[model samples]
Target: MDVAINYLEENFAERKIKIQAQEYLHRFYGSLGFKQVSEPYLDDGILHIDMLREK
Candidate 1:
């Protein structure tokens, strides 16, 4: 994940990145600069939430 994010930041010129992550893993992503952007929701029966990283 770190590698992919670094690749985007270095090469893609992206404004922001968004992901639907498992709710319990939010903290893991938060360490990578992602912040929760949505309330908990279910996806394919798994609890998940939206997160985003802005450039």
Candidate 2:
């Protein structure tokens, strides 16, 4: 996933976005240098979090 993200980041110079499956997945995203935006909240019985990484 990291490799794919790096490819997208490099290929899409105009658009900057990263996605994860769930809030728990934030840790994986963090490993790739993404930062959590706020506390996680319940969404359809599951937790969700927003994260972003600037290029």
Candidate 3:
């Protein structure tokens, strides 16, 4: 995870990295600088939330 993020931080020109992650993993992603950007929702019956890490 760190490796991928580091690569994006160095090479990607986008303003942020976005992901739709399992709702229960919010804290885990939060530790990596991601913040919840959307309310919880179900995707194919699994609870999920949208998050973003700004550049």
Q: Which stretches of candidate 1 lie over 4 Å from their true place?
A: none
Candidate 1: give the clashing pairs. none
Measured by TM-score, the strongest candidate is 1
**Which stretch of 10 consecutive residues in model 1 shows the poorest summed lDDT?**
6-15
A best-first ranking of the candidates according to their lDDT comes to: 1, 3, 2
TM-score of 2: 0.67
Over 1-55, each residue of candidate 3 has an lDDT whose tens digit, in order, gives: 7888888878876579999999999999999999999999999999999999996
lDDT for model 2 comes to 0.72
lDDT of each: 0.93, 0.72, 0.92
Q: Please provide TM-scores, in order, for all candidate models, with all chains considered together.
A: 0.90, 0.67, 0.89
- Per-candidate clashes come to 0, 0, 0
lDDT of 2 by residue, 1-55 (tens): 7777777767876245645347888878888777887678887888888777766
Q: How many backbone clashes does candidate 3 have?
A: 0
Off by over 4 Å in 3: none
What tens-digit string does per-residue lDDT give for candidate 1 at 1-55?
Answer: 9889888878988779999999999999999889999999999999999999997
Best by lDDT: 1
